[model samples]
Target: MAHAARGADAVENDAEGLRRRVAALLEAHWDEARGYSVPNPSIYPHLWLWDSCFHAIVWAALDDPRALRELEATLDGQLASGLVPHMRYGDAGPDTWLGPLERTSSLTQPPMYGHAARVLADRGSRPADELLTRAVRGLDWLWERRRTELGLVYVVHPWEAGNDHAPRWDDWGAPGRTRADYDRAARTAWNKARMHDVTFAADGSAEWSSSFVACPAGFNAYVAFNLAELAELLDDAVLAGRAAALAEAIDEHLWDEEEQLWADLAVVGGGASARSPTSEGVMPALVTTDRARALAALRQLDDPDRFGAPFGPANVTRTHPAYDPDMYWRGPAWPPLSYLFWVAFARLGLHDAAAGLRARTIRAAWRSGFAEYWNPEDGRGLGAVPQTWAGLVLAMGA
Candidate 1:
């Protein structure tokens, strides 16, 4: 028993070291001269809210006020309707997918302002009104935009959806991935099938890497939680009424009676004919409502056949054939998704569930060394171990 305890201690120490190193990588990779708005860590050397929020988590430790500033810096990029694009382009760097759009357009992530806002909420220095007001603006944007048919938020692109391949996609055609460039079709193909199409094995040595694609689960769940909070925070009775109505609509519409999992949307139309049970989809229960149906959706987690994992929740249920343990977003225990689940459970008063998941996530992070994603069963680090968001979750215990 003593030896086992020592082993556990050693593992914890190794995990802590990895977390520290990941944080250092984030700071070092940050293009400070570019005003901190670009060159984010998670999605590559570009400014992305997904990375920025996690970046805020670490910066919170170094300087709480600066952490809040980090979020504020990203806010400046909001589009006309307050739509925050998933990413903003920095000065020329490596040629990457979504590279062209990043240079030309201004887009944002799903409204995850609440996560960042709550972080600011922890800092008494920022005026509550200021923090709440900015957060409310972002929430208002989500209310105005991003909703799909049947009231659930509709993310136009995969990046916004976060959990790319929920079970629903199996019925529709699998999402086709693009080749990286003329030089690396095989590597890109390998990435499309095995990795998240973001990275791949340069020479087949199990060296996990990523490219510039986004995940659907990360963004969908973000809006689910943000909108739920907006329903509570909107000051105007009319706006509050609208927010509540939208929230309820989401619950009713998204609560899939058949699968018992929330799908991205019913993809009947030719353009949107790809439905999936993205990790982000489960977020309605995780963040918005605590109804029995929502809870049932989470029960999918225990479906040893579907999502149950020794480390943390897999991005997709195992019942799906696409379920590849090493596939980046397809089947892995990711920190950000788990962190969102952890907090969502807490918000819904499921403290025990939240704590249990938190503990599991911490262990997974330690075991996987804070990788971008880990094997759900073996806890081996998969893509970009020491990815920014994984480290952020560990540091904040989110």
Candidate 2:
């Protein structure tokens, strides 16, 4: 909070110190045998899709070769059909919900490796040529297989949106929102009831669960962003066109002008999306074609009544009935998400706002000791301590 009042030189110096601390924490979370940074050595103990992507970006910013190794490690357990699983257990042991034989998750998370690869190359690191090809395979697979009729990448689970605790999926529970009302037990039950809907093959591909097949604005924005960047890096016209079309589709179908935020489109049509204003709702600014729409969505970050926390953007509106500054995914200021907003803001020429977020995020990461997420209201650490993704503030402030 003081960052806004502090002199620019002082803020930059403070950020450099925070960067050093984050770099050390990232190193501590690195799993040598696994070749990737675990989210939290104690709590998570496994690699995740978007987390590793954020780690790679921070690693590259630090000039660490681990950045390349992290990306390579991410390809492990990838399906033959090019679906990049959201989680890879390796020797850490499969999660109980994943079943004994299953290692990688059947579902995919937000696709950000393409954007990570671009960040790596931008840093002058020649990630193997095959890496780009591999990343595109996953994107292509989503477009061909998981795409809803809306032309947006359809995600089967809320985890794919990476905002697991957000209220968008509250319809799953009736008196309790399908037990999704901050109840992990109920959420798990809700999951098992329909887990059999999708049948997996030997190749790790599954018939996607159609009941929850919805296009989340945040998820598709990352896909569209990755495609657009990869297209430029690879010089592919077809991919470029697809990226443009995807972005345009997000505008045409998902933009909720009244909310000034992108709303997740539920195909089945029951809840109408709860209309909960989430930080991820602004993610479409990364790829949306309309400058006015992008600016308006991004300015939500500057509004105190909405996302304007002293730390990075709040996970939800402060006015929301369920806003929780310390709850995971409820309203914490996550470094990776803040980093995304910073990038999006800068891309649209909102440099001042982006800089404020950069300072605030780095400060929060510092004060929270690189926790998994921080209290949006007070910058107190919550969730896993010394998590690697918080290190992403290095790249954000840089």
Who wins the lDDT comparison? Answer: 2
What lDDT would candidate 2 get against the real structure?
0.78
Output the TM-score of candidate 1.
Answer: 0.75
TM-score of each candidate structure, all chains considered together: 0.75, 0.92
Candidate 2's displacement at residue 66, Å, is 1.0
* Residue 55 lDDT (model 2): 89
Error of 1 at 21 (Å): 5.7
Q: Which residue runs of candidate 1 sit more than 4 Å off their true CA positions?
A: 1-26, 35-43, 61-63, 93-107, 125-135, 165-221, 230-239, 267-275, 287-290, 395-398
Best by TM-score: 2
Compared with the true structure, what per-residue lDDT tens digits does model 2 show for residues 1-398?
23322433344457557667777888888889889988887778888998998889989989898889998888765788888888888576643454223677777788888888889989988678788788989889888887777788877666777877576766644123222454556656666544555556567665466455568889889999989888988888988998998998899898887889998887653375446688888999999889998988898887889888887789888888767786676678888889899889888888898888887877677667667888877777888877888888789746
Q: Can you give the lDDT of residue 300 in candidate 2?
A: 85
For model 1, where is the 10-residue window of minimal lDDT? 200-209
